[model samples]
Target chain A: MKNNTKIRKSHGSGGQQSHDLLENVFIPHFRNSYLSDLEDSAVLEGWNGNIAFTTDSYVVDPLQFPGGDIGKLAVSGTINDLAVRGAKPLYLTAGFILEEGLEISVLDNIVRSMAETSKQSGVKIVAGDTKVVSRGSADKLFINTAGIGSVPENLKLGAKYIEPGDEIIINGNIGDHGLAVLLAREDFGLITDIESDVNPLSSLIRKVLDADVKLHAMRDPTRGGLASTLNEIAQLRSVDMYIDEDHIPISDTVESVCQLLGLDPFSIANEGKALFFVAPDDCGRLLQILGSQPLGVHAARIGTVRAGNGQVVLNTRIGGNRLIDMPLGELLPRIC
Target chain B: MKAEIQKIVDEIHTECGEEPIRLMEVCGTHTMAIHRYGLRSMLPSNLQLVSGPGCPVCVTPIHFIDAVLQLATRDDTVICTFGDLIRVPGSSASLESEKMNGHQVRVVYSPVDALRMAIRDKHLHYIFIGVGFETTAPAVAAVIEMARENKVTNFSVACAHKTMPEALKRLAADRQIQIQGLICPGHVSAIIGIQAYEWLAKHHNIACVVSGFDPGDILVSVLMLCRQIKRNECVAGIQYDRVVKAIGNTKALALMHRVFEPCDSEWRGLGMIPASGLAIKSGFRRFDALYRFPVKVKKSPTPSGCICGDILKGIKTPLQCGLFAKECRPDSPIGACMVSSEGTCAAFFKYQVVKSCA
Candidate 1:
């Protein structure tokens, strides 16, 4: 209720303080018909098809980063997860775990960002919960989001439909999200204005789905970037993926940053990007549809699917081939 | 392929006729670049490229890691190190595992960052694990100087830094691998200069060419070495001359000399080489963590069937190691070579190895 007040354990006790905090903060931003009811569950009335559901948690260090923050990232990530499966995202549930000393203003900013993103993506925040813990018990704040989407009965997409002639296309440049967050940490004594490409991909994916192309499979390259996603698909379907190093879109800034840190751009994290496997005949049409959108301006066909043992290969810039293995553990900067 | 690079490759193949030429690249970055770019696939079959004792983490003796682990366990100490060394196994555990046990083990980009932390938190003794070659030693030396100037008594470095020339000499003397040419490290040459490698060429009759980390730079360096071998001229040349000077960076060399001196150091692959390791000077002895916190380090045996030692010495390839991709991998590394990202085994596993258990 007061300006600049820090979070306290009593705020999460479900007492009067909790009521005041929720009424003053979350409700106004996320006010909707289902949420206004204040029921234990928001029973919806429009379920005539298969449902796609996903949940993800945000614990990024430096809660606010270039371009987007944890709140926006959490919403975009879960929505993209469902969208990649060709689902129309409908509703989301947010749960917040606040550290005792986190500032109220910071919490407000994050919540506002989440509400804005969900609204822009045509999704509703229908249910939520909040809890505050003692300092040091958790990082400043952690947000967990669960999303529900409707899958059309006529539309189907999966790795099982992939074949040797399928083509791999990406939405845009890679490594922006990871590099942006790394630079935001400001520990490397390096300066850059690179921003995270964290955005809800439901609209972009919806356009692609409406274009009526032969979409075999789709994956949002989030934590493991495009490399791991492709490898996962390749291994899952027992097909080989051969991507050209030059064709995979990468911004100059991201490329230079990854080079300075001795990191592979393919293995870095991306938030707003998705990979589409399409029939070779419809690859150009898919690219055209993707390129027409602001989010997919840099769309490019990176590689092709091959019938072989499960493997992902990259043709280097110098006309040589190398394997794209799943990145091991933590990505650490090289010593020298 | 670019026509220019293809021309160089053609020249290398032509020059390296029936004779088998073995070239060793002594920098970890070079080792990673070679495999990352698939340069070996571009080279002629007769031309073999082997990795030398390049990776600082791969070449660091396990005893040094054990010593750091002992220091990391102390309540009064906070270990700061490059990210590469955090996962290196000691006799029993790693710094990463120790930190998971609630000890303070921080990954710092530079030694000076640790000094900055020491200045802020005066209560904890920050022991920076100094593990690098000449390319990194100057930065470590500069940080120690800054610590001394700022009068930060709690900051110290556990030095395990190694020099390249001596290790190269040890490799050159070995009769097993028969290394005929060398692709000298680009960054190390920038610090120590082209003159440092002259002896290996002049005395040992081995062709040497300092190279940058780019795929083109490496191929050009290889072509230069092949030309030198064709002419029977054994001397050090520089292909990365834009950054590396003939005499190296004198200011860095002088700063390094002022703060440290050459001492006998233990290398993981090569046995003890005299004057191959850098030790803090007596005047700056107060900043040596080994001097401040004395921890007993009993030598531990290398992992069974890990040919990392032989691999580092150019005596064997990662493919020859029994545990290379089967048991030892980047995810669950059993040897030092598989731990560091720039390590030979790690590079081969990540880039070259195609078959996977899946």
Candidate 2:
């Protein structure tokens, strides 16, 4: 294997430099039999029953962050998307657009993270692509992952299956991923060791399937955070959402950071958490089961579905009610 | 605390009785908290909660945004601004749109971040869009001080800061709204002091209660306002006793006074009011964008029929505007009030989800 320590513009020239990167960097880490074919696409046996397909692009700044790098985020985000739909992620394809002058060591670490995350999540990186542009053309690095997963025929889930009386539950706290990443940027000069909650949720989700707690709907709140996720669910189901403020789990650190920055924790992003809608009867048992797991320890029943037009409301801890609307514009640093 | 809040809420509901008690919350953050707590839905129908000129982003005049846009278009300048300012439309263009069209606009977390950027990169001029109410002016003033101490020659600030008490006084005197009381801002009150609102109460004969951000604090303040009105008494009080003081933060006020002085500033809704906006003092004129960058902010025509000014003055609600929920939205906010996340129009559009059934 050749030791290329840096990615030059020629690395994406589709010439000897590109070949060197593929052989030395990509192949050894993701040397599946099908991937080794070096064909245009990897040929694989399709799932027996149903399949789930998802594509996500990761463009988080400061390629490497506290808990994970862009590579880990890319892989985990795809798998989480698949897992929330009751699908077992089987194969993922990674595409990297690296900026010129990025050290190969950084790429190597990211690649290693992606490989390890894929293996741990029971998925294979069967195919991948890499491109390097001028330093000004892109940020340090951006990764896009497309995953193909197998959905068991017995598993049927969507907003249509969600009922008005169904209970909404979150795996853990909100705003960790966003706040972690924000602090990692060090733009605000705030120093905190809050790691990004960027982990694949396939295992914990599979546990729910095994428990058979009658989960109706699930979503991994990513970009717009939990507010957008619940809003999507509410709009899709055409039902009102009542989220209890006291029940929603938020760490003291995340809460304080949000308060200082005037950001709503509910509106901030979460990468590793899953929001589940289940029947009220099974919600308690499901919460207990989720609480038993590590990721779900802070798991809680946050809200209830009501029969009305699509609306998301937060029942404040002070016994008042307020609308939890979609995030608008941007979360500016506010003093008041 | 919960029971006490409930007790107050119950009493306010009973006392406010059929006549439709109109109270205006005069802070952007209060508007957000009111919506976040779903307080509007929980309040009695007879009690109408109106928004005032408290949202700095909503109340910012069109010319201020236009001035910032001109500075952004300059190749020699790196425009630093808060998140909401980037999206706010200025006549034909916005900072966000300008950025997309290849202008250099950096969305910063705070004025301190802008100061840092100016210090780090001396190759380009940095102009921070200092836009906010008194609650934020002190921080911007601090940045100006930092810029001076560091001798950051290329750093300057475009001031569009508003004063809260003056706006509230004008809001109270407006005959169209008929607002019975004012739920004053907690943070602004902390800086300007709870005593700052005494003039508003004394002169306008309106009940003013500086309240905290919590739902309970707001509910209790509303109840206090109801009690004041019930007794036909006009007085000022502070519900946020822990954070706010009678005389305000003297140190911050001193810094603000040292860096800036009151100037007749134009507001998007309220028009030109005396001593209602901050302008960098002549001694610090070199750090002021209006003085350093002489850009003629041509009186660009305001968005036709945009009721942002009316909404900010509490003369009209977002729903009263014809474009609301149809043409005016947070994503493509046609009115200044719809631009900020805390803007009354954006709040109404987003929270009014359950309004149809309610």
Candidate 3:
């Protein structure tokens, strides 16, 4: 196929056209033996503790934005989901839904992005499928990735382990990805240098795990953001938690955009951030380990857990406290 | 800044000693800010900050939403609205539910964007859901003027725009909630001016402060309100001095006056207030969605057993409502109060519903 060729329904019809499209477009980028075979599924040899599996689909508007796109988001989002659970992600399956009139070059760009992310994260796109819909049936492209990982037998991490006096630590800044995508859409016509913090957390999580700190719980603050993740954990464990508003790292640019748009940074999504609950004694060491990694440079101890009914609070900057309710529906811009 | 806020808070605590004061913040932004900063938790027990009906989405009647839904589902029409209106329940459905059902409902940040869309797609009639107070009405008015100037025949506004003073006058006359003070909306005052709130102070003896949407600003306003109440003074003052002026933005006001006029409007919680809503002027009748695309709208009441009415009146709080967090939640909102992020119930749910640590 030529570089300027547009995708058609026949390309996903599982015929010679499908084979040619896959061979020319995807196989070269994700050229591993398992995927190169073009079999029904990738057969893995025996290895393992408990299996960790997760899946996520990306339908971010604009498809391309500052720092990341839908393709990069798809790969990292799935990988991060597994990593946050103390799992070593090893394999991923990519499924593409291409709108009929989409340009092949656009698909190639996104596929290449996915391949690069997979390579960097030490995960392989071992199995894949593609389906094309008629014009207006779907967006330009949507990528769904399901990841398989191995969790160590001795690793125990969950909300049940969360207790009073435990410290809550988060990696880097919050509200980057959601705001970046929103700004890229140009619906608000506001320009900013903020970029999406969309990257895999496997390396950072691996470092923390290797250090062997007293990890109680871990979560990747994705769609509903840090507030939702914190609230969910608090509810599950029936423990109360409060994070200081002054301590949560937020970029000046991100802060301004959120303020101008009437959005709460705690509730806005972050693609590449994680929350860790650790014993108070191990808090210093965890910070040290997190600071050493490039992705965790801005990591800080945000809050502490307490014994109470399930509630997540924010200690305001001016020596006051308020509850951080779990965000609901979409985070819409306030009109008044 | 934190130190200064503490000083003001301390002053407020000292001035209103043991004197029961019920103050209301008459802006949605103020409602959110008051909760966002946890001011209620910090304030003395003698002072109560109640939420008023300042949220445009919360105050927008259900029949207005039903009419918009009708326009949205029509094949020949496209409905453009702010994001806040998407999830708000109408009589039977919402804009969100209709959008999922494959309707042409779009969320635009400004009215001009909708006008531009209508200009671009001349084949489809675009109806912008003009909801908001004085702060937002000027932009809609300006966009309507732009459409007429450009001769954009396909664009119109289903105007639900409302003025602030009429609602305040109605609230002041209510015998149920004896509100002693008010934190007037800063942005609305920027459009309509501080004089608009003078009636509440002079006629009703309510201490009013046009407040900015900041923790420090709100704290200062609280201090000012406490001072006014202590001195036995009833007057309207401006705490958000930088943005709002005594006369306000005359250009925007002039533009608004040219495109729209005062008309009786229905509010969800507050009921009908005479001349509280803006209707497109007779000259711009061609750009009025109500006149252009007439739809039969059935009378729709507020949801059953929802206390958003009493909540809006400041006679009741969300905790007093039976359906607050149980049947009515932010996820599946049974009333407009829970649906709008700026709604008082939503603010409480998001930042103040939990037990106070103080």
The number of clashing residue pairs in each candidate reads: 0, 5, 0
Candidate 3 lDDT tens digits, A126-239: 999999999899988888899999998877887788899999999899998888887887668887899999999999999999999999889998878888999998898888
Of candidate 3 chain B, the 10-residue stretch with the lowest lDDT total is: B349-358
* lDDT by residue (tens digit), candidate 2, A221-310: 887788888888888879999888889999888988987887888888888999999999999899988999988999999989999778
| lDDT score, candidate 1, position B192 | 92
Judged by DockQ, which candidate is best?
A: 3
Query: Could you arrange the candidates by lDDT from highest to lowest?
Result: 3, 1, 2
Please tell me which predicted candidate would have the highest lDDT against the true structure: 3
Model 1 pairs in collision? none
Best by TM-score: 1
- For residues A86-197, could you state the per-residue lDDT of candidate 1 as single tens digits? 9999999999999998888889999999999999999999999999998999989999999999999877797788899799999999999888887887577778878999
Candidate 1 C-alpha lDDT tens digits along B7-80: 88888888888788899998889998888877887888788899888899988998999999999999999999
User: What's the ranking of the predictions by TM-score, best on top?
Assistant: 1, 3, 2
Runs with alpha carbons beyond 4 Å of true place in candidate 2 = A1-3, A13-16, A37-41, A45-47, A328-336, B142-152, B194-196, B353-358
Which pairs in model 2 have colliding backbones? A321-B37, A321-B38, A322-B37, A322-B38, B269-B309
Chain A TM per candidate, in order of listing: 0.97, 0.95, 0.97
